[model samples]
Target: MIPVAEALERILSALIPAPAETVSLPEGWGRVLARPVLARVTQPPADVSAMDGYALRAADAAAGARLRVIGSAPAGHPFAGAVGLGEAVRIFTGGAVPPGADSILLQEDATAGDGLVTPTEAAQKGRHIRRAGLDFAAGDAVLEAGRRLSARDIGLAAAANHPWLHVHRRPRIGVLATGDEIALPGDPIPPGGIVSSNAHALAALVRASGGEPVVLPIATDDRDAIAAAAEAAARCDLLLTTGGASVGEHDLVQSALAPQGFSLDFWKIAMRPGKPLIWGDLRGTPMLGLPGNPVSALVCAVIFLIPALRRLSGLPAGPVETRTALLGRDMPANDRRQDYVRAELARAADGTLTATPLAVQDSSMLAALARAGALVVRPPHAPAAPAGCSIEIVDLSSLGV
Candidate 1:
């Protein structure tokens, strides 16, 4: 068995970032930038008006000052002539600030009629003027490589004159479920049969982690069936097989993968409810064998698989986000295995975060997991903790619901 951190290090060290592809800015959000995006043109391009007002020399824009309206400058139509003394240009919002105009008199403070305008309020130099390249300059590094593009980032990139961006390709993850007793959702169940939900859950997880999920057909426990499914999954960049990872008599995933020259990196983790986790390289693709229990499979995916997907998408391998919370009840000493206890979260009147571990932590209980908002992390062999003890927790909100 290996520690969770060690396992993560091993997995990350063996993988490489995915290849790059050019995608339209609309489709670039949530994808990692493979190269820095430089500004192709300056924002605002030239000095412009920030509001609909009269652009004139600041000295002539005093209260009760009168000036002749030489021309109008609405957005996209620049006044060919400059503003001279005692002259003003009617500039609308986003309109270019005509030459010789150093300030603006807002329309609310200025009355205009008969090809002339009068200032009812004082104006100062540079007011209401958007200087050229105020937001960004040409050739500026608008965004750096390894950034996960957000909606705001996309907007900024578009403002930087980028119609498209070079970003990492979303990895293709293949998910396989192996168990004869498991049936697809809505399928008629035989005695003792259960719905095959791991694949679906894993597919959603993959998509949430910025990867495309291809759910393979469920494979029975038979060696041939599992082997055929394994081959198909191996064609993807990453393969995730749920069930048949343990050493049980019926656990045949490892055995089936052996004939395909799968190079096992590690097969167990020093973590409760997920000790049977498996990691290895199958053909040229990375593979992970998750335990059969639903909660265990999903938890391991959150801990390990998501980060792998993030790295493959050219994103920084950031640590799992954790926050400190006070324990709402007593917790017993843990054994050799590190524990991730699902817990409900609440905030106290004093803004203190409190986490209460669910009474039952059975790996198959998806209901309890659903109700949980955080995972209370307990290291292996941790001492018993009384109520009010501070504990580290991973907020599930960060991990897509």
Candidate 2:
């Protein structure tokens, strides 16, 4: 048996990022940046007004003094005339601040008349004027390579004059569930039969990890049938299979993979609910074989499969978002394996996050998984944690749940 970390490293190294693709800004969210995006044009290309106010010379403005108004300016329109000493121009939000004007007196503080204005207070320098290149300068590296596009990122790119974006191509992942006793939903359950749910669960996992999942049909526990499915899955950039990985006599996933030029990277690990894990490569496509237990498969997918997908897409997965939370009840540590305890996060009156583990923790309870906000990460060496004890919480919802 190999250690989990070593197997993870091997699987990650075997996968590489796909080629870059040009996509529209609307469709680029969560996609990694393929090129260093520079500011093609400076935001607020010139000095502009941030609010509706009077643009005037800051040094000359005095409280309660009425001054002549030069012209009017609104958003997307610039004043044709400049402001002279003791003169102010009527300006609205997003309008260009006229040349030689250093500050603006908010409309509430000033009174307006025909070509005349009055200030309620002395206008201060650098007030309400957004200076040219304040947000970004021309040629400035506004976004670095590998930055994942978000909604705000799209806005920034637009501000920087990017009409389109170049982002890393999403890796195509194949999801398969193997076993003879498994049946799809809506199918009549035979004696000792269970539903084949691993594929759908894995598809959601693939989406959460920023990859596209191509779900394959259930591959029954037969050497030839499993081999044919494995060969087809190898066409994608990565393959993920659940079940048929243990030492059981009928487990044929290992044997089927051997004929397809795939080598075993690992077999078992010191882990609870997931001792039959397998890792390898198939025809240049990396594959991760997870236990059929619902919770175990999901946890392994997040821990191992997700990071592998990140590497395959050239994304920096080291910065996964995690927060602190207090345990709602006492918990025990594992004997020799790590454990991920799913829990719902509730904010306390004092602004603390509390992780309350659900009572129904059976791996088959999908509803409980859906209600969880995050997983409380505990290593094998963790001591018993009492109620209100703080622990590291991995944000599952942030992972695109």
Candidate 3:
């Protein structure tokens, strides 16, 4: 058995980023860039107006001096005429700066009558003109390599005239649930039988980590059936198996994996509720064995599956959103292994996020998970935290695949 962080490190080292491919910007969200994105065109393109005003030389705007108005310029339209001395052009927001114009006086600061303009106050040079390439210059590496694409990042790329982006593809995941005691939900349950929920929880975990999950049917305790399912699961980028990871009499995942060339990386994690975690490679595919408990399966998936998905996407780690918040209540004493306590967050009048831990954290309780938005990480052998203690929190919203 090993610590969760150490186990995660070992699991991630097995997989490598394959390569990058060109895809449309619309489909680039959640993917990491393989190479830096260079800007093809300057943003703003040219000097443009920032407001509805008149453009003229600043020195010509003398007190109470009226100037003849030239042609007008609006967004996407250019003024063919130039502004001569003591002359101004009617310009709206986003309009191009007319020729021989050195400043822009807002309409509020100026009076217009009879096709002429008069300034009431002094204006400075380059007041409201958005300079060319103000946001990004052509040929500049606007987006660096290994950067994850978000909705706003896509907009920035589009502003630079990038229609297609080179990004790492999403990882494909295969889920296998093993056990004879667990009955299918729709199947009839005979004495001492329960419905299968571990695989369903793991499938949601895979999607939360930004990977595609394909759930396979239940693999009974029989060695032949487990072996057959493991063999079929090798084609996916990752495979997650629930149950049969312990060394109990009916456990067959280890023995079945040996024949299929799966080098056992680790078989256990030194953590609460999820001790029987198995990680390795089967025919070059990354595979993980999670404990049968629903919460344990979900926790292991967050620790291991998240990182694996990130590595597959060419990122240093799978994209999990994190934030710093204060603990609002005292927590239980932690064991040698780390603990991720589910907590409900509250924003105080002082603008501080206070995380109050949920009282119930059993390995089988899915009801507790449904109401929590963040998890408070407690390190191994850590003492209880009093109220108003700051800690790191992994937010639920950032888990996009």
Candidate 4:
């Protein structure tokens, strides 16, 4: 069996990023940029007022000084006349500062009368004025390639005059769940069969990773059935299969697809609850085979599939992030395989996180996995750790798992 990190490295190296496509600004949110977005126009195209006040020559506006009132300029309207000596123009916020106006006398600090205004407080030159290109200049790269656009990024792109953006197409993933003992929810079940949950759960994980999921029908534990179902998903960017990946008599994913052009890269990673993982290619499509158990399937997906999706979607690809936390309880020494212990996380009064392993970590118990907040990572052959010992953890809540 290969180590988990080596398996992941092999999978990512075999894939490529999705192609680029054009999308409107409204649809660009949450999409990764394929190219940089340059500013089409300068922000604050010209010098403008940052506050509602009077625009005038700074030297003429001393305390108690009076100046002749010129025409007013509101936002989107430029004062046609320039401010001469002892002259002021009434301006509102966002109004272009008229020529020869080097200062702004705040309205609250000035008294106005018929055709004239007096400064109660002296005006400072260049104060309350937004200079041209204050935010960004034309031709500047406002957004770089490969960045996932957020709401704030959308607004910045819009302000930079981008009506449309070039972004990488969302990766299309085909999810296939297999097993003779599993049936769809709400369908009449076969004797002793359980409802299929792996497909839907993995689909949600794909969406969360910014990929589009195409859920294929469940393939029974038959060679012809598995081969046909996999062949049907050859056009997808990636094909994810659950179940029939182990060594049992019913596990036929490797043998069944061998005759149909499936090439094996590696199998059986050194990890707990998910040792029966499979990574290979079916025809021309990349395929990942997860374990049959729901908890195991989801956990493996979080570690492997999420990073694969990121690489396909043109984002910087790497393992899911982890952080250090104090152990809330004692744990025994680990053996050969790497372990991911499901645990609950809480913040102590000192604002430090403490992770406590759940009582039951059975791979088939989806309820226990749902209640878990994190997965405390235990390396192979590591010594036992006691309460308050520092440990690395994959935060499930942060990953939205």
Candidate 5:
């Protein structure tokens, strides 16, 4: 079996980013930008008030000085007249400063009545004034390409006068679960069959990673059935098959798809709970085959499929992020195969994280996987580590898994 990293490399190297499409600014959130968003107009178009205050010349607004009130300028309205010699304009937040105004006297610091205003404090030049282009200038690239747009990005784009944005199309991932002994949830299960959960779980993972999931019908453990189901998903950016990957009498994914132009890149990987993973290509579409066990499939997907989705979605693609944590218990030396131990993560009073492996880590125990907060990573042949040892862990909650 090859190493896990090699298998992931092979899968990502075979894929390309999805094509770009034009979408409205409202639709751009969570989508990867395909082109930079340049500012069409300068922010704060002109000198404007940063707060509600009186706009006037600094020299005329000394402490206790009185000034004539010329007019009022609220947001979206610009003062037409200039403030000359001992004159002030009533201004609110975002109101453009009138011509000849060099400072603002906050209303709280000024008393206004009888068409005149008195300053309780001295006014300083350029104080409380939002200068033109303070936030951004016209023609500036406000957002860069390849960035996943967020709410803040959308607001910035709107301020930059962008009504539409160019973004990569969300990758369409087709998920197929094959097993004669598995039935869909709420469906009639065979005498010894169990309910299927891999497809739905993987679909949620796809959505969380910013891809669209298309769950295909469950294919039974037969060569024709598997081949036909896979053929139908050739149009998808990537096809995922769960079950029928290991070397069992009924494991027919490789043998069945071989006749249908499925090119085998690699079969097993040196990893615990997921040694039977498969990465390959079906005709022109990339294909990833995961183990039948629920926990194994999800763990493998987190390691391999998430990166593939990111690549296809035009985002920086790499391994899922990991952070350091202290081990809460002793761990034995690992073998040649890499290990991802499900564990509970707790924060100490000192703000450090401690990861403790779960007592029962069976691949079929989905409940145990749900209760796990993190996965303590154990590299191949890693020496035994004691409690309080610094270790690397993948935080499941952070990934929305």
Candidate 6:
């Protein structure tokens, strides 16, 4: 068996980023930008009022000083004439501060008569004005490449006068779940047949990772059937197979794809619950085979497949984020395999995170996995850990993908 780190490195090195495509800002959310977005127009193109008030020279407003009301400037309607020494322009919010206007008096702080306005508060210069290009200047870089656009990012791009943005194309991932005793949900059980949940779980994972998922039909243990399913899965950019990965007597996925140029980069990783993971290339398309166990498949997908999808989307490949948490229970010494123990997370009175491992860690237990908030990582051959000891954990709450 190979180390988990080596297996992940091999898988990533064999993959490539998806091509770029132009999409409107409305559809750019959650997509990685392919190129830097530059501002095409300056915000507030001109000096505008930040409040509905009278715009006048600051010196003209002394205590109880009255100025002549010359003209009114509502939003989008600017007074063509400038404010003289004793003249004031009635300006509303977002209205252009007429030329030569240097100060403003809020309507609530001033009294307006037939032709004159009286100040009830001191007037300050540049207090209620949004200066030209105040937020951003034209031609300035608004956003950098390789950034996953969020709702706020889309708004910023639109404010920068960008109607459309170039983003990486969503990677198409074909998911195939293979097992002779697996049946689709709602199907009549055939004696010992179990519902196949791996495909649905993997499809959700693909979508969360910003990839388009295409779930293929369930392939039985028969070689011909598996081979036909493999052929159909090859059309996608990446193929994800669940089950028939372990070296069991009935395992046939490896043999089924061998004739189709499936170059196995690695077969097994030194990790508990997911040791049977497979990574390789199938006729030029990258492929990863996860163990059939529901918990194992989801955990492996989180640790490996999500990062691969991020890389394919032109996003940075960073280390899997982890946080330190106190163990709520004792754990025995680990063996040769690195262990990812699912645990429930809680916060202490002092805000410290605590992870309590479930009693049963069977890979097929979906109930226990659902209640897990973190995966405490234990390196191969790690010493026994006692309660209250600090340990590294991959926080499930941190998974935005």
* Cα lDDT of model 2 by residue, 240-285, tens digit: 8898888888788898779878888778976555778888878677
Q: What TM-score do all the candidates reach, one by one? A: 0.97, 0.90, 0.90, 0.98, 0.98, 0.96
lDDT, candidate 3, residue 243? Answer: 90
Q: Which candidate would rank higher by lDDT, 4 or 6?
A: 4
lDDT of 4 by residue, 260-282 (tens): 99999999999997999999998
Better of 5 and 6 by TM-score: 5
Model 3: residues with Cα > 4 Å off, grouped in runs: 184-187, 318-333, 342-347, 351-360, 372-376, 383-401
Question: How many residue pairs collide in each prediction?
Answer: 0, 3, 1, 0, 0, 0
For all candidates in order, the CA lDDT equals 0.92, 0.82, 0.83, 0.94, 0.94, 0.90
**Model 1, which residues run further than 4 Å from truth?**
348-351
lDDT string, candidate 5, 1-401, tens digits: 89888888888888899999999989999999999999999997999999998999999999999999999999999989898998999999999999999998999999989999999999999999999999999999999999999999999999999999999999999999999999989999999999999999999999999999999999999999999999889889999999999999999999999999998888899998899988888989889999999999999999999899999999989889999999999999999999999999999899999999998889998999999999999999999999999999999999889
Q: Which lDDT value does model 4 have at 305?
A: 97
Residue pairs that clash (backbone atoms under 3 angstroms), model 6 = none
Candidate 5 overall Cα lDDT vs. reference?
Answer: 0.94
Better of 1 and 5 by lDDT: 5
| Model 1: colliding residue pairs | none
Off by over 4 Å in 4: none
lDDT of 1 by residue, 235-257 (tens): 58888999999999999999998
* Clashing pairs in model 5, backbone N/Cα/C closer than 3 A: none
